[model samples]
Target chain A: MNRDFAIECERLSRIYRSGSIPGRGRETPALTDLTMQVPKAVVFGLLGPNGAGKTTTIRILSTLLAPTSGSARVLGYDVVKQAKQVRERIGFILGGDRGLYGRLTGKQNVRYFGALNRLNPKTAKRRGDELLERVGLAAAADTLVEEYSRGMKQRLHIARGLLTDPEVIFMDEPTIGLDPMGAQELRQYIPELVGQGKTILLTTHYMLEADMLCDEIALIDHGRLVALGTPDEIKRNFSRLTIFEIVVNQTSETLTAELSNIDGVQHVETSAEGIFQKITIAVEAGVDARDQIQATIGAERVESLVVRDPTLEEAYVSILT
Target chain B: MAAALHNIALQAYYSYKGLFLWLNWTAYISNVFIAPVVFVVIVTLTGRFAGQSDSANAYIIGMAAYAIPAILSGGILQSFCYERTFGTLSLIYASRSNRWVTYWSKGLLHYPNGLLAAATSLLFGWLLLDLDFSRLNWPALVVLLLVISFSCLCLCLFVGNFSIALREWIIPVGITNGLLLITSGVVVPVDQLPGFLGEIGRVVPLTHGLSALREAFEGASLGDLVDDIVYELVVGLCYLLAGGFLFSLLEANAKRTGTYESAI
Candidate 1:
């Protein structure tokens, strides 16, 4: 148990013995031999597709479930052996669907959960009010959660998760069901929380959110971790394969051979779309094929010639596949 | 420990905040007034036809005796079903309140409401039937209600915790309601329930508890009600202990398995 690490899991795995769902039979392993470490105050993103074991990992770390076999520690407390301690250290927000109760007011819901966390009435009330204000729900704090818009409800849920003032927060799809503006609101708020020195572990399949918010990311697919690194680090690793898109003014069959003949040009494909020709060229290692390719294609007919570093989306696809 | 209990109680109070108070009071009022009235009317009609020497007041006492455990069993099981169905039970688990505090507070708070209803109805019934209980066995009646109520609360938690599937909530509520309706000895005395059924009925705390209640209203001494009261207390305690233990075990297992959400 490293004092500086907020979460540590060694060979942690989960096997869900799901009852057959129509077309499938037999138990399936939701997670397999998973291992990860999250340092204190770091915003780590668990990036994965649907059913990619993100929720399973969060649940295990939150002490909501025991692993089938392996160990997990949250804030220096063993998840299985010191579940109550682990629970106390970690605040968990489980998606938008499990938002605050529709009938209770925002303050009321927060106070209710605070009381359950063993806060006295005065302390609970004070904490609840502070959290409501922090989440920007203080103006509508008295209104029933049912009256709150989707974003307000989401903020209230986040407020409820903070009632205990946990050192580590686990958000399993914080902005999944939110509208664009709602997602943007959380996008701004989350980084602020991270700035407050709270370690956050978030899961989302949205590359944009991961890229914008995560300091470090682990990409999981088909229950296996495929990529783990900072966004810039990952982009740098995949930069060696440069993709160039060329739009030509005229269609020419001979252009393929001409582009391929350029130094370091490994692959070229051209497709004609009405009056314009779309060409893709891949440059080989240690190659500066741009000027050579431009000259070969005759720059006057080339409407666009752009070469750039890979986006997280392109990098993710390339790494996962 | 007290703070822990207080926190648990407050959480439970809020969990059932709006509708529970109304529903519980309704269940209480109906149990107190309507149950005994229905029992008295039926008994009086039969007595007139059969020309039996049995007093309507004695029947009222029997019905009131029946109301005590009826309220207990019905109160606990029905609320458990409602919590399970409405997804509130899972919320409680997720919140991390002490399970024992939940069981205790739920039983404690709801039992009073049930007892209030039972007493009000029984008092009304006794007045309507011209009953006098200046020498009633107070200890026996108190013992019966307390023992039975605790047992019912335990049983409800036990069943509710174990049956995690949404559909599983039905079986326990149905079984409990059916058991109380037939074997409660509130409507028909245990002796008239057929030999095998009567023996099973006797083993049920409902039969013995109701009998003790009748004896109490008839001015039976504590000594006279001792055997039956002992039987109710002993069996009810056993059920309470066993049921509570089982419920905690299931709750821990469910948390470990991450099935709390699916179960609720």
Candidate 2:
């Protein structure tokens, strides 16, 4: 119940019962007893593998779904009991093109959603125009949504979600189908939305997108919170090892054994790429075991060697695996 | 308050104009404009083929009255059905707009559309059926058309409650249409219909309303037919209220089940 937190959930959980059979069916749990909070005026990213409950959490907080157990509050209003208040203060840009009215013109679609949020006609018109322009859809405002491409439809979804000028915006894969330029522009717009004193909770599969946009990222797996921290903190804390990627003509157990036996070598993984066998070695933070490993492999078998810091994507994979 | 009214107007207009596939010019022309005329033709031609050309006027009157269910019911049903298909119903449910206002206003445009189609059928009846226009009480018949059209709209609103919850409109709409055909005295007399159908005919829209319509066409006064018109109106309102109640109940259930993201 912290007032500073824009979004708060206490052991929020949801189970979907499949009523496929007459009296009995399997139950699927989309979210566990997950408690999390996002502060105001920042981009909070939820990163997870598929079916990790990111969308379910968004749906609950946005007042689109109710928790089977526990509770969630957005902007200090209960998502279930005070849904009207919550819906009035929040907006959501859910992924996929199916949510929009395909037969309506872009402007009409905006106007329709504005009306649903009870936006006054004149204000809706002005704000709809502003949002459509901001989303790069002003020119196509008069065009039927069915005629628009997948990217254009997505942009319209953004415009519709912003029509109410919500305090907390939940975006589920906002840039999923956008072109590179559109995606880049949308990413740039995220912080600008935050700058307007709005809290944004977004879910995306792009590690770089989360790294670049999220002030704090929460990674969930199998309906549970797995990791939560700033991008740099996660990358640094989760993995304090420099990685060495070595290419060889081929690798044998002897080479792997020798590399693993080297002092300060933390972990070694092998995979084949193209015609060459690649050996990825994780080394301890303060240990320079590179010369010993390369010497053990010998110069004749060593095709190439590259050293680099761990990326957010690499850290994410390490923690998840 | 004004904004809420605006929401209703916008939702009603956009639902009929954008959400329904009948907005497409070709579909509109073929389905809305052409279909009613075809229905009238089939009934009149059937009467002629049965060597009962004298019964053509009654058949045309019965058939013309049918535009209420055919036009208004379908129109109102689509307001609920297409919203689910487009995944916008869930969006509306998640919003702060008044659900009662949104639900009832869905048939605003459709009621008038049904009346227009009914009038057109009447005009076609006068032109094609060699019917007597002199016997028709224009004022009383106008009231009858309006009442029956609204009643049918309400009936569809009732059916729409399930059209959305079940995520299948075709079956419900088709069954409703078939029931009206057999039980609403569109082509058969209500009393002449078999036992259960006769009872059903009394409860549905056109049976009572159409009886009054035929009387009004024969120059019966509106005051005398008030009982029948009232019965029709009461039946319609009952359906509408039931629909509204069921809609609220389903919404709560959907929230609990978490199926509002799409129709279940």
Candidate 3:
């Protein structure tokens, strides 16, 4: 394992076998020979759709689950062989509101987990107080966890995950069930943790969140790594087609066909809203279709036109599809 | 080593904290005292109707022994089941602290609760019934309670292993409670049971422990009950070892199967 990489997995494969009775099950592979490395102190995002093995990868790296055949090392410690050492240096928060004790206060939950990580009593208490404050949960520290809102509970989860002051943190869909403002608030803490030299492996299905937070991203599909790069690099490399969105007072098959026939235009799709027709055209790289698009649709019928680079979502869709 | 000890202590603290802090006093009293007292009264009354005073005294002692499993099986079931249901089992498993140590800490914390319930039942039996306590061997009774509590905890651990593996605690705990009640010589003497079941009862820790308690109540010393005490200890240790092995196996299987990620 390289010391510079916070996490390194070599051909990791996890196959789950299922059957009602023992020795009579079919095997389903969740991860297939997936090899990747995450550099230290980077906010690494594992972006994928649901059931894309992102959580499986996080679980294996964090020592909650063992890979079926391959090896994974976190911070120079083998996840399987040196699992306790790996656990000592790492922490994780899974998505949802079920991890905390409903009967215990928010502070009590943090302190209990701190103790589980073997922190001394005084240190655990101090760290719990600091983390609760940092996560905007100090005000609700003494409230029973069951009474806290989903966002408050999620913040408490974050505080508990950080109680150990781990060098590497794993967050699996941390903002999965939060409101827009809650998600925005949680996003602000990622950079702070990364700023403190902690390597964060975050898994999310939200392409926009990944784009905003990740320094490096790995796009996974069907248990395989499809693309890996910085957000801008991925947008530039995977997407070679620019998008043109046009709003017209009226549109029909003739206009769409005419736009499709324009030079360098690969495909033209049209949809009719209540009072306006919208046209999205994909054009080849280095080709400008502004003049042709305007001429084909007629300048008088056009209400608005916009030309821009493909977004990360468009890039993700293009690569996956 | 110190950290491990600290972890255990903290686990116990948190486990007990939840119980004491959240559970209402009325609920706690009803659960710990009412059920055991009612059961002892019913058994002693039935024995008295049969005009078997000796059997009545035996029934009272057996009912006191029954409290160990009554409190422990539920406590153990909750300890394992609640974690999975609450989604904290994976977090606990991922921590640096040893899983076995954490589980044992919870078990050890519940031990005193089980003893308290057992004592309540015994005290009620003495007060409600005209049972003779003047000849009771105090040290021998203490030893018997200790042995019975440890043995029941081991049995609970064994049941807890299966509960995690199956991802269902209610059924396993229920079956265990039924089997122990019918076969552990609590309401019926082991010698009077059917041949195979009586043999099974002899192997159960409660049978030996209850027999030892009866001997102590009848003025037998620790030396007189050495054989039964030894048997109880041996059985308790075996259950503990087997439970530990099963817990490891199920945990490894859960990891390999990805069941840890699934909700119970």
Q: Tell me, by DockQ, which candidate is best.
A: 2
lDDT of 3 by residue, A221-267 (tens): 88888888999888877767788988999876688778878899877
Q: After superposition, how far is residue B205 of candidate 3 from its true place, in Å?
A: 1.7
C-alpha lDDT of candidate 3 relative to the true structure: 0.83
- Model 3's number of clashes is 0
Q: Where in model 3 is the C-alpha error above 4 Å?
A: A20-24, A245-280, A284-291, A299-306, B1-6, B16-22, B261-264
Q: Listing every candidate in turn, what is its Cα RMSD in Å to the true structure after a full C-alpha superposition?
A: 5.2, 3.5, 3.1
- Model-by-model lDDT, in order? 0.69, 0.85, 0.83
Off by over 4 Å in 2: A20-23, A239-242, A245-280, A283-294, A297-309, B51-54
Better of 1 and 2 by TM-score: 2
> Once superposed on the true structure, which residue ranges of model 1 sit more than 4 Å away at CA?
A18-25, A238-298, A301-304, B1-5, B18-96, B123-147, B162-168, B191-204, B222-231
Which should have the higher DockQ, number 2 or number 3? 2
Clashing pairs for model 3 are none
Please provide, for model 3 over B44-143, each residue's C-alpha lDDT reduced to its tens digit, 9 standing for 90 to 100. 9999898887687888888888988887887777777677777887887788776667766767777886788889889999899866788999999999
**DockQ comparisons of all candidates to the true complex:** 0.33, 0.62, 0.57
